[model samples]
Target: MTLDEILDSLEHDIAVRDDGLFAGRAIIDGRCVDVIGVSRGAFVGVDEALWLSAQVMETIRRGGDTPILVIVDSGSQRMSRRDELLGLNECLAHLAKCLMLAGQCGHQTVGLLYGHTAAGAFIATALATRVLVALPGATPEVMDLPSMSRVTKLSIDLLEDMAKSTAVFAPGLVNLEKMGAVNATLDPAQPLAAQLARWFDVQPDRADVRDRLGESHGGRPVAARIAQRVYELARHVG
Candidate 1:
């Protein structure tokens, strides 16, 4: 579905600004949520990252226990020499921290993957949410398959064949679900507003469970083991 359609289904009285970030106060089944997202498939830059951070902070400052709904459609980070020179990574990190702080401040953070959710854009925004739901056919990937093949020195055909059997290196939302990246996938034909309301009302735990879910799904057993081992080592460290 288009961004506007999604927002209309889930929110009422939407207000969009000139900055490319759209937000509206949504009331779902008596639950109030602040829904915010970037539009026009905007390549997120340092400035956009800072804007997002400010939005999350301001939501917490408002002190309403309002849930934050993040709508992600970004394909990637902006490709600008100036952005990189001025510390793009640092800006993205700040955004991630602000999202985390919002959760710590008692807001239920949720993300809806509507369009291209890829690379640093996903990490800085949607990936930090407490619960993430992806629309059917939405592709969320670390990188495109050809790019991954080039980076890993693997043949494209070989990677494609492996992706058919395993989701660890695959790119679509279905594979992402198998790897326990997204909490759930929403059907486009179904009513998303009620589903979102239920998700908000349920109030899932904020703790990170991807590693455990991945292990249970048999998609990435080593991830949980490795994390546990690292935690054990850190516990003994001075």
Candidate 2:
């Protein structure tokens, strides 16, 4: 689904603003929530990050039991000398912290990924959400396979073959689900608004269980065990 279609489906009432930013009040299952959409894909810079941070902060300041819906389609962080000079990393970190604050203040955060979600853009925005849902055929990745092959010195064909069977380093929505990075995948033909309302009504606020889910799905067998061992060691030392 495109950004506009998703918004139209999920939001009974919405107003689109200039420069790929939009805010609206939505009612789901008799509960009201605030929705924000950022459509500036390809590259998200400091200004965009700060704008998102402010939106999240304002929601927390309002002090209501309103959930936050973030519609993300960004590909990566902006690559420019000016953005770097202006502390892009710091801006992204601030955005992440703002989302974290909203969660701490009892705001349920949900991310709907309808397009390209990659690298720092994914981490600073969508990955910060409490529940992440992706549309069918949406690709979320750290880096493209060719780039990964260059970085890791693996052959492209080998990586492709590995991706066919294992999702440890693949760049697809199904792979993300297998690794527990994505909570659920939505069918495009289904009623998106009703599905999202059901998710909002039923999904619980809980600690990250991606590792456990990954193990259960047989994608990452040792991650949970390794984490437990490290925690045990730390407890013993302390």
Model 1, residue 81: what's the lDDT?
A: 100
Give model 2's TM-score versus the native structure: 0.91
lDDT of 2 by residue, 13-103 (tens): 7776566767778876667888876775657789888888888889999996688888887768887899999999999999888887787
Clash counts for all predictions? 0, 0
Task: Give lDDT: candidate 2, residue 70.
Answer: 84
Q: For candidate 1, lDDT tens digit of each residue in 1-238?
A: 8887887686476676676677668877678888878766777889899988888888989996799899888768886998999899999999888888888788888889988878888888888888789887677887888999989999999999998887887987877777778878888888888888767765546667888887787777788889888888999994
Off by over 4 Å in 1: 202-206
The segments of candidate 2 whose C-alpha lies over 4 angstroms from its true place after superposition are 40-42, 202-206
Candidate 1 clash pair list: none
